[model samples]
Target: FTRQGQSCTAASRIYVHASLIDAFVAALREAISKLKIGDPLDEATDIGTVISQRQKAKIESYIDLGARTAGAKVDRCGELPGAAHLKDGLFLQPTIITGVPEDSPLMREEIFGPVVCVQPWDDEDDVIARANDSDFGLAATVWTNDLRSALRTVQRLDAGYVQVNQNLTIQPNLSYGGFRKSGLGKEASLEAMLEHFTKKKTVVIDMR
Candidate 1:
């Protein structure tokens, strides 16, 4: 739940290979459950309040829909903190929903909250297709030791940035942007600066 999943780069949808789904989910659940949810200003906080009450409510509704409408098994890993001062805080329990359908709304939309939906796939080609099926192709990540597969997946996935064996990281001096509806132009690097700052003028002289 990094930054309470307010980041657009957050891995809200995880398409795990079928063989590793059980192990991955178990590990994720354990890790999420152990995170410290408290005052964001506190140095000890791992998960914090999202942004506001409205966002909290929207996220909570998505979590509920993941279970009620999508038939996914929702696991709310922990409790909201009990500090009296934080009683009214817009904090949400880090949630993981598994066994969700590929086409589930929770899987498709950008929840932009501390919620993740997981679906399993058995075929590499199929998984690649499913991962690229989204309209928002901001960024994607592939975690595997197989270099060939990683490279292939990276090329096939329709995302502006594709990380191999890494998540939520950007290279220095590189252009950062999104594909499809996630974004239009780059954000960093010289390319972005040129795109916005420089104008092109074509002057043609015809010599008869």
Candidate 2:
């Protein structure tokens, strides 16, 4: 980490390790490639259009911004842009970007699209260090066949929630929140029971 990336890298956020990073990214890339980018009405399509036209435009703008940044690369299905003609139904292909700079806008901003950004680290400690550096402690998952690493990471990560050996979203029973900008507070049955309510009182008395 240099002066440029050092700040963002340590800005209280989560980051993945270099060793495990590539494999996880590879798995996601493979899955994204398999996604069918087409109209929902078309049974062959695996994914539908953006929730709103605004979101479609947002993705476009994000891509544009990414292109200008350092080593940014975006790849999407050739059919996605053509699908725009389906005005009644919007659709975009799965987009993947590599070589994105650590401090680039693409990495700093939340990309809630098929688009994914990849950055690498050295080891488990590095990954945990990067993750904890971020202000956002929303959620993180560690995927590995190794039970020891999974258990250790879950205990050490700064995020409110950590799912071991499972690369997925927050479950209903699990609490969810970020340590910083990622969230204001956590919400979950367990968390609620832990600190959702409280009571206190003071009684004054005189003694000689």
Candidate 3:
């Protein structure tokens, strides 16, 4: 997002191998470029329909926000060929946007969809700042082979959960909740018990 000079909240994460920001970008480009938009039931489809026309419209608005508010440079929207067969389908192209600044309105909003924004950071501090600057603090993942970077990311990322070495963290013992508006409740484990429950004080000073 910094590239587009826009700001973003913690939507998702773009992890890198510490120093290879360029390589990470290249990989993201390749991965996003290859998504095939079509029917989910079809085994050949790489990408599938977005659910409904409202969802498609919502996703597109964010694209517009990225371009106008965040300064993100966007590629032309690709029309899915296979989806054309459907009379009224929710097929929308996968999008990859670059140049969103860490603090733009484009980055701060939550967009739950197939659109992935690949952002590069100079250091952990930079990523942490951008990651936390938002109203929604759902979840974030840090991908790194270095234990130190992973450790620090966990310590600094202001989210409810920080998954390391993987994009997802789903364990029975770990508790999950959002920092802001993303969510207010907790679930999964003992951690939730602490966050969700209120403590009661009982007095037992019976005239001893």
Candidate 4:
């Protein structure tokens, strides 16, 4: 998980098609297994500690919540740093969870840590609806090769920023922000300058 999944726009709720869910999870597990968990200063380390112990606990609570869910499966990879290496630092193993219900808090809340929830989708409309059901709609990604399907899904998604077959990449020239509870205004670009950073006023003298 990049930046320990701490970014606001992290791809947390991954909705894969029913046909690909199995293979997707398997590949994800394999990829996660190779991640090196250790000191942040170490070049060999792929993942480091979260910001603090409180954040570590918050993420662990979500993991526990997923485990307690009836059908949800919690998956983790790599080993925790040994005490000799850890030295009281806060770190969490990257986690990948599947079969969590849509209504569960794990799916609903913004868990700003190294945890992700994978769910399967069948119908296009249903998947789109499910994706938009959340209060947070900052960013979304559609990973389909079909142009038609990608365009269709992209246009319908409620996120302020949508990516096609790419990870979240915020560029300086592009307007960046979110919808609903994600945020109110934008950052970067001209739109943000006019709408968020600047105020507009009009005055008329008695020309008549």
Candidate 5:
């Protein structure tokens, strides 16, 4: 759902093992390269215009920063696809950045665009720590075939919503919310309904 990565559930940061990092990144680049960037009305368009010019500029800056940062490599998804009417509109090519540091701006802040940062991790402890280092814990996704590893990692994540061996998805029956600075309160479930309608009562006794 890279509506140019504007969605809150977008997988912005990916931590991959050294053995499979190259393959994963290659696959992502290949997939991104084929995206059809053009007018929203076009049925062939996989990517449409950004919300505004300011957002486009911000996303571009992050891409540039990712390229300049040490230990970070930025790969743009080549030229924009055929978009006859989108020439003057705010359209940015899909980008994939690898070797990103945990503290890099691209990794630290929400890009809210079609830019994803890839980092390699050798240790599970380190990866979990890096994942939780974020101030925003909206959601997290753990992709692993091993059940033990998936459960362990999911338990350690500070995110309010978590998915194991799957991409971020919101079902109607699930409560949607975030931890830390992401947001407060809940929405879209029975829990949210109770939270909104139920009230607590306190009684004091003067027996003292």
Candidate 6:
């Protein structure tokens, strides 16, 4: 969870194909288990604290919601730092949830913390539709080896930026923004300056 999953472009809702969901969850759990949670300044710390106690509480509330929701399973990882190390820091272990309903707040809203929701998909068309069925369309990532499938999925995704086999790889030169409720206009690149930041003026010359 980069930057404690606070980034707007974080991969919060992950939809894995039914065939690979089991293996993907297993691998994710294993990876999270090895993460060292402690001070951000510590070089060995793989996971750090959230921005504030409010944020930590908000994230924990979502985790609790997932736990109480029927058919949903929450898997929390990593060890909490000792009371001596915690002090006033707001640290939370990484959490992965599965079997959560598509309409659940955990899946619909951005947690903006070290929590991710994993859902299984069977049909490609249905999966793409499900991915698009969200208020936020900031970014999306498709992980597939088939070039044709990847390209096809990328074209159909209703997001401002779509990446194949990558996540949060936006460069400065690329025109960056979001669709729908994400944002209004772009931020970087020449086009952003010209279209979003610049005002156009038309001059007229009368007679000769």
| lDDT: the better of candidates 1 and 2 | 1
Which whole-number lDDT from 0 to 100 does residue 31 have in model 2? 68
The sequence of per-residue lDDT tens digits that candidate 5 reaches over residues 1-208 is 3687889889988899989999999998998888888877778788888899899899999999987887778888956755465569788888889886677888889889988888888999988999999989988998888999988888999998999877756779788888888887767799886895578789998996
RMSD of each: 2.4, 7.3, 5.5, 1.5, 3.1, 1.5
TM-scores for all candidates? Answer: 0.93, 0.71, 0.75, 0.95, 0.91, 0.94
How far out, in Å, is residue 188 in model 2? 3.5
lDDT of 2 by residue, 92-134 (tens): 6666666676666666666555565666777767667755765
Stretches > 4 Å off in candidate 5: 196-198, 201-208
For model 5 the local lDDT of residue 185 reads: 74
What is the TM-score (0 to 1) of candidate 6? 0.94
**Candidate 1 vs 3: which has more TM-score:** 1
Tens digit of per-residue lDDT, candidate 4, span 1-208: 7889999889999999999999999999999988988899899898998998888889999999999999889998888888585878888899999998889999899999989999999999999999999999899999988999999989999998999989856888799999999887898798886898778899989988
Backbone collisions counted per model? 0, 9, 17, 0, 0, 0
**Candidate with more favorable, higher TM-score: 1 or 2:** 1
Candidate 4: 10-residue stretch with minimal lDDT: 80-89
**What clash pairs does model 5 have?**
none
Model 3 earns a TM-score of 0.75
Clashing pairs for predicted structure model 4, backbone only: none
For model 3, residues 97-208, the per-residue Cα lDDT tens digits are 6677766555666665555566767766766777788787767877768898778778888887767766444567778676878666777787677768656578888796
Q: Work out candidate 6's RMSD over C-alphas.
A: 1.5
Query: C-alpha displacement of 181 in model 6, angstroms?
Result: 1.1
Model 2 whole-model lDDT (C-alpha atoms): 0.60
Candidate 1 RMSD to the real structure:
2.4
lDDT of 6 by residue, 51-166 (tens): 88888999999999999999999999988877685776888889999999999999889899999999999999999999999999989998989999998988999998888887
Q: Tell how far residue 127 is off in model 4, in angstroms.
A: 0.5
